[model samples]
Target: MKKTEPHSSRSQQLEGAGLGFLIGFAGLLAFQLLGELVVRLLAIPVPGPVAGLLFMSVFLLVRKRTKASEPEPLLNASSLLLAHLSLLFVPAGVGIMTHIDRIKDQWLSISVALIIASFVTLFVTAWSLKILIRFMNKPEPE
Candidate 1:
């Protein structure tokens, strides 16, 4: 005769089989919803998801400071999401294909705008990095 331990073996199995992804996904949605609510209530111009992300980031920082006891489910979910991040771009790719004709008409302008924006972004990022490095290297005042 054998005795089975009265633990969450079912949950453990489900988690191993990717239930963590669902929980993580749910957590993401909850944060997004919370963000949306805050944006609506505060009448902020920022997008709801962005606000939610900011909130989530602050929560993580606070949790870190408090030395959270349990494992962070978001970390696993985020890893799984990142693993298949490319899939998220499919809708945009499909949209482009759907609007290929419209895009064809504006191709040159779009190309120029994209190129200019890319260069500007690179320049700004480089400038910011230079300033940051200078600030970090500055000696403390006596």
Candidate 2:
């Protein structure tokens, strides 16, 4: 019987992460394509990629509920990427640096828009969750 070396273990870990990333990326692309198809078929206004993310979320939820024995390797990979996700936005931040003047010109309006949107989103989310909880807690009629 042969034993696996320590370096081999490290290589396997890297391979796992790489494979996981590929799986996640493929899943996202497939979701986006399906969403785009559905949107086009239904004449919906939402962007395909956004719908894809929603689809992916629902898939993940269903997988969690039904596939108890299968470990979620892709989800773990996605979460690992998310954990260090700020690095992914560094290029966007750098690009923003080059658009300083344009941002300055529209800073006030942009800031106001962000503030309003943030508040509205916060209020709506809170209100909806509260209503949902109240409805859930209500006793059924006898």
Report every candidate's CA lDDT. 0.84, 0.82
Please give, for residues 38-101, the per-residue lDDT of candidate 1 as tens digits: 9999999999999988988987888888885633578778777789989999988878767889
Cα lDDT for residue 141, candidate 1: 41
Candidate 2's TM-score reads: 0.57
Tell me how far the alpha carbon of residue 42 in candidate 1 is from the true structure, in angstroms, after superposition: 1.9
| Highest-TM-score candidate | 1
When summed lDDT is taken over every stretch of 10 residues in candidate 2, the lowest stretch is 69-78
TM-score against native, each model: 0.75, 0.57
Q: List the residue pairs that clash in candidate 2.
A: none
Q: How accurate is candidate 1 locally (lDDT)?
A: 0.84
Candidate 1 residue pairs that clash: none
Model 1 weakest 10-residue run by lDDT: 67-76
Per-residue alpha-carbon lDDT of candidate 2 for residues 20-118, written as tens digits (9 for 90 to 100)? 778876766788899999888998999987888788888878888998754455666567768988999898888987889999899999999999999
Superposed model 2: Cα runs more than 4 Å off: 1-17, 97-102, 106-142
